[model samples]
Target chain A: MKAFTVEQGIVAPMDRANIDTDMIIPKQFLKSIKRTGFGPNLFDELRYLDVGQPGMDNSKRPLNESFVLNQPRYQGASVLLARENFGCGSSREHAPWALDDYGFRAVIAPSFADIFYNNCFKNGLLPIVLDDAIVDQLFSEVAATEGYQLTVDLSEQVVVTPGEERFAFEVDAFRKHCLLNGLDDIGLTLQEADKIKNYEQQRKAVTPWLFADV
Target chain B: MGKTLYDKLWDAHVVDTRDDGTSLLYIDRQLLHEVTSPQAFEGLRIAGRKPWRIAANLATPDHNVPTSAAERTQGINGIADPVSKIQVQTLDDNCNEFGVMQFAMGDQRQGIVHVVGPEQGATLPGMTVVCGDSHTATHGAFAALAHGIGTSEVEHVLATQCLLQRKMKNMLVQVNGKVGPGITGKDIVLHVIGVIGTAGGNGCAIEFAGEAIRDLSMEGRMSVCNMAIEAGARVGLVAVDEKTIDYLKDRPFAPKAEQWQQAVDYWRTLVSDADAQFDKVVEINASDIEPQVSWGTSPEMVVPVSGKVPALAQAKSDVQRKDWQRAYEYMGLAPEQSIESIQLDRVFIGSCTNSRIEDIRAAAAVAKGRKVASSVKQAMVVPGSGLVKAQAEAEGLHEVLLEAGFEWREPGCSMCLAMNADRLGAGEHCASTSNRNFEGRQGFGGRTHLVSPAMAAAAAIAGHFVDVRTMVEEA
Candidate 1:
């Protein structure tokens, strides 16, 4: 995985709130646990009127021309600007996988659900929490200027606008370090292998019954 | 130096602290299910490593497991979906290969792993429980510090008995006064979510306490804690009480007599002091809560059953307005329609959230003599566990349900999710007692309105989503 400091990316604003994980990637696409293939199918239900069928008429498909994702200006967008309470509902990690796979390097929102926010950092996606006014400003700027690009510097923890309107956001130092290094919870745990091994030895001696095979 | 239940549990499980201040917390029990475990099991096989503590870990095939026993008995080849069959079979094979105990398809112990763990005493008080399921916080009713982990973290826990972790900030949520009649644990959680909003509890471990919480039964407490994730809390807990002790006694994995007494003594000390400190605190009067039902897609968008759907223009914030519009469009609900007047196509009363024996008994009490309305498509009663199902059947609750025209099904995650054949057809709406009400949560284009089991039963009889209080009063 290539880790970038997120220098600059176009912000495609999605004005809807409570945009759930299922909407990000529906249940039918959840058949495969492999994280890579899900990006293309993200929002398949909303994008296509009839999914998973051959020779289906696309002429009658409900084309949501107003949707930020479907707009030609936001095509190949790397930064997603969403409203508050984004990524609610299920804790499926596929939501972040789809976001990352769709080439979104960072997500700027007023708030995010606890599980989805945590899942984002682990999957090499940055979820930045900004003030409501700041979020509104970002949305307005994106609406006014097509394909607006904002630079996010992980080293400085600041999001800089096109006009150099920079706002600093706070993230846990450890989590920031993990995201910078592309280390997940498991990768971090594996770094302490010696300590884990020693604990296992001591625990085995104390509770021998637990070590026995069925 | 008074210790909250969280403090005692965290202290007991701390194996060591590294130089960076991260604790190597030893997990006493590791629970696994079908969805998150397959990838972790694959990681283990690729690395050629067995479970570090095989006896301490347990696996169950839920989530993707077919609730219908007949379908399950027909084997993997008999299933319509090849992927679900593969997922279940992989879990079965992994458990056998690793010599870990598994509650498989036909096993009586099989259920939602979160439900099965506590009911069987595999989740003990003061133990650090880790599961590859987000609702693992359901085990916190027993005073266990249970939390969910990711797939890679599951692999780490299997190879090493410890998990690398950062500590959460503490928050005390005190629900005071007595709960009014007709309100259940599901209502309490929904009301709490509404008060706190979805993101209010972020970065904190919430302790549900005070008189109202203390009065709840073990199952009721589990239901309350189960939805903590819905409110953005990392962990939700309740102190061990007599109800907890009583529930744990005689279970297969519980401590023996002498050890049990000692364990209870330790549990008694797990309560917070009168002046215990918390980083954040929220107080709610239980009496103020009503029969809450979700009007919008998110849990936090719920209101009292007597309330009407909210208009987007009346929403307090722009985001709220947009969310209201989106939810309204997807749910096919009018902003001014009375929530109680909305007709229901189906009623699903099961899942880890509200599928306990008490939940069934509560629902059956409402459906005893009443007949389900003909307009209702299907009203199904699925117990959380086979043990619960058997117990309910012995009490003639199943007969009462069938007599009332509700389909009785075997235990699994039936209809709470669209997985399996138990699903609502296109454009169908349901009165579900499950935790989430997101669009297509039940099936593609299937609308869900979360309510209490009693409320669900009443809806089944009335053939529309209505308050159970009215039914109780009429009876």
Candidate 2:
């Protein structure tokens, strides 16, 4: 995981709501064992006219000219501006891997699906939740400006727009800490291994059947 | 204040709670399938960690396993697609190396992880279950606190058998009144998603209670809870009952005689207190529900079979109007177009959501004396697992399906995710029993109308969406 402090990058606005994981990274692309290469097929259905297969040359694929990310102004965008319920389907972490792999450092949305939201934090991709009106304002600003960018400060917990508007967002404290430090969740949880074992022992004593090997 | 079922399950699973309200919730069971587990296994190997509790994990190669008889003859080697074979083979290798228990591709017990879990009694009441697949919420039907996790969290749970979690608000989706004839849990859940849009249950663990919910069989309850993720809630619950106990009675992983009694006694206490409170409540009359079909891309873009494609003007907000407009263009349907008038190229009657024995029986009942319409290119029934396949075959349901021109294929998640040999072609419309109708879910450029098993079967025979209730009445 990469540590996040402050990321300032061009904003790409996906105006539609309920932009599901399938739309983010389609099911066909989910076949890869390695998570890193999904960047090429991010939003495969919307980004490319041809059906995306795993090993195909994505760079040579015909780009859907009308896709927001394909537009010249939004190229190399790191901040994704989206509507409500972005990443709404599937619990595929591939969705986050694709976004991160595609050079996106953060996503600003009115809301997000629960699993996708959690998946983002694990991958060091910040998913900032602001009010719907605030998101609408950002979307408007990004669409109106040619080279719009937003500064996402994880420590400050604010998305600073180009117009000098600082909109604060809420993130879980533990998640914030992990994102800021780029901490491995496994390492953090393994530190409390003794506590977990104690709880397991007590639970076993109360319900021994659960411990039985079948 | 009395505790809700969600509260009871959450309280029981808390290994440790931090000041920020994130608890280290102990996971009692995990179900792993091909697509998600490979990456997690890779992560574990990179981190030099083994599964914290091997016995707690149950795995199968479902997502990418071919359902065709010819393709399945040689087990993993039989998978036709190279990429899919690698994904499934990775699970086999990982499970073998990790010494985790698994039902490999050829194993009769092997199927969708969610289906195999409850069928094998690996998922039991009061246990906290997690899977790499979102449909893991299906296990919550047994009063378990189950939800989906990402690959990173899958690896996290592998290294430490606990998930960092905050408590979710409780929402009760209480369905009252008797459903009309031929109504299934699929209908109820689709209705629920329609009543509460896709994101309605976001941030809440929804408890589905009331007479209608209790009236559903264990399989039906599983079907309802299975799509809870489609309803935007990670956890979906139904309190413990006689049906739940009866369903788990003598399964392989179930407790022995005395331990079974102990387990049952504990499971009995898994329900919500009588005076329990909920953060939100949604009341529905079961009688009001009809066979549902998703007209558009999202699960919330659904209506009864009798309803039409909603006019753009009917969209409550500008955002909704855009979504509906996109759906209309993609689905190739006009506003006010009748669902029944929509022709289908294929019909799929299997998935973790509806491939259980009961679902198979319902589809078979509808297909018994009818031929699949010539306009329908294919109608296939892929059972949830080998156990479900054998059960359906023993009941002679497969014969009825085959006689009706429906392909009675081998058990796996065939066509559900299009990871296998079964999938829709571009511009093809399918009446499918799978959960999501999202764009390109079944196949690239494929249009899917989500339906129940019976509805899908009826659609196959009719060459279009027809009311399953009408077919039942005709019979």
Candidate 3:
């Protein structure tokens, strides 16, 4: 897990709504056993013209130049700006993996799919939910500037733009702490090992059949 | 105090709680599919951990399985796509190494994880169930608390057999009055989604109540609960009843003999108390819900089968207008056009949503004595599971479908997703019974119109959507 502190990065806006995980990284790219190297295939269907096989040279593939991420200005953009229901479909954690792999540190949306939102925090990606109007303002601000960037401060729970405009956001304190300290879900659960063990004992007593494999 | 079904299930499963309303809830069962489990197993290996309770896990490679591929035991040799074959193989290896039960391809029980679980009696009433697949909501028909979990949460549950979660608000969608003839569970759910909109049920556990829901078969109940995700609710349930018990009797995984009586005794108490309060409630008259059809890219963009598509000016909001415009363009549809008049190049009759025995019978009933339209390049009926396929075959349902020019294929989530070789090519229009209708959902540049199996079958024969009830009357 990577500890996320305050950082400024250019914003790339994806204007579509209900952008499901299947589109973020199609099922074909999900074949790989390991988590890494998904950056190239991020939005594989929307990013590339031809079919993307495992281990193919992505550089030679015809890039969907019209897509937001493939555009010249948005290149190297670490902040993703988007609309509502940003990750709805399958509960594939690969959606966040592809987003993080594509060099995004944060995703700002009016709303996000529940599972995708949860997966983002676990993978060290900051998913900030804001009011629709605030998101609209950010989109306009990014469009107005040539190299727009926003600074997200977890400790302060705010995002700042180039004009020194501050937008407050709410995050669960525990989630904020975990993201700031680079704690994944497994790591946090392990901290409460004793409690979990005690619960397991109680569960066994009530439902002993659960402990034995059939 | 009176309690809702959601409350009863949650309160029973709470192992611990915190100040912020988060609770560590015990999971009674975890269903695993190939698409989502690989990463979780990899995470387990990285963390150097084993599944907390192997007995609690049941897995099968469904989403990417080639339905026509060799028998269950033959390994990946039957699959041609290296990527898909490897994905299924990885599950086989992972399950074998970890000692988790694997229903490998060719096994009669190998089917959609959601369908197999309930049929085998692994999905019991009053239990907390989680699956990596969103359709896990299907299991909630037995009066259980079930929802989809992400891969990380999958790994968490695999390691701890519990989830750290906040309780969702309870919602009761009461459907009063009897449904008119030709309406099925699919129509009821589609109507609900249409009335509530896509995000209407977000962050709520929606319980289907009223006489309409109570009268549905177990399979029909599963169909409605299965598409709860389409309405933006992760959890959907119906109170357990005699229908649920009758369906569960003497199944392979069910508690046997004396224990079964005790289990039924417990399940009987799992329904919402009469005086229980829900945070939100919506009412619908079942007679008002006709067989439905989706005319656009989103599931919520739906209308009754007998209705005409809305004109662009009818969109209530700018966002909706934009979405409607895109959907119209992508689906090659026009406003004011009748849904029945729209042509289809293909049709699909499977998915966890509508792939049970009853669903097949419904479609077969419509397909019998009807020949498919020539314009339909392909019309396929894929069963939900191998067992479903076998039973359908024995009952001559497959013959009825085949005689009607429908390709009666084996089970698995074939063509519901484009992961497998069974998918639509560019610009193909398909009347699909699968859950989603998002852009590029079926395949890139393909158009999907979500419908019921009966509707899809009718579309296959008519080359477009038709009033299935009208056909029944004509017959």
Best by TM-score: 2
Q: Give per-residue CA lDDT, model 3, range B1-475, as digits (tens).
A: 7999999999878877877667888888999888889989998998898787788899988988876635434656777788888889999999899998888887888899999999888888877889988889999999989999988899999998889888899999999989987888998999999998777787889999999999999999999999888888899999989999999998888888666787788889989999999999999999899889998888888999889889988888766788788788888888999988889999999999988999999999999999999999999888888899899999999999999998887678888887887888878989998998877778887899888888899898899888888887877
- List interface RMSDs for the candidates, in order: 3.2, 0.9, 2.0
What is model 3's native contact fraction?
0.42
Residues B361-437 of candidate 2 have per-residue lDDT tens digits of 99999998899999999999999999999999899999999999999988888788888778999889999999999
For each candidate, C-alpha RMSD in Å? 2.9, 0.8, 1.7
The runs of at least 3 residues in candidate 3 whose Cα sits more than 4 Å from the true structure, single-residue gaps closed, are A200-214, B69-73
Q: Could you give the CAPRI-style class of model 2?
A: high
Q: Model 1, stretches more than 4 Å misplaced?
A: A51-65, A184-188, A197-214, B16-22, B47-50
TM of each candidate vs. truth:
0.93, 0.99, 0.97
Please give the CA lDDT of all the candidate structures: 0.81, 0.92, 0.86
Residue B267 shift from truth in candidate 1, angstroms: 1.9
Q: DockQ ranking from best to worst?
A: 2, 3, 1
C-alpha lDDT of residue B366 in model 1: 97
Clash count for each candidate, listed in order shown: 0, 0, 2
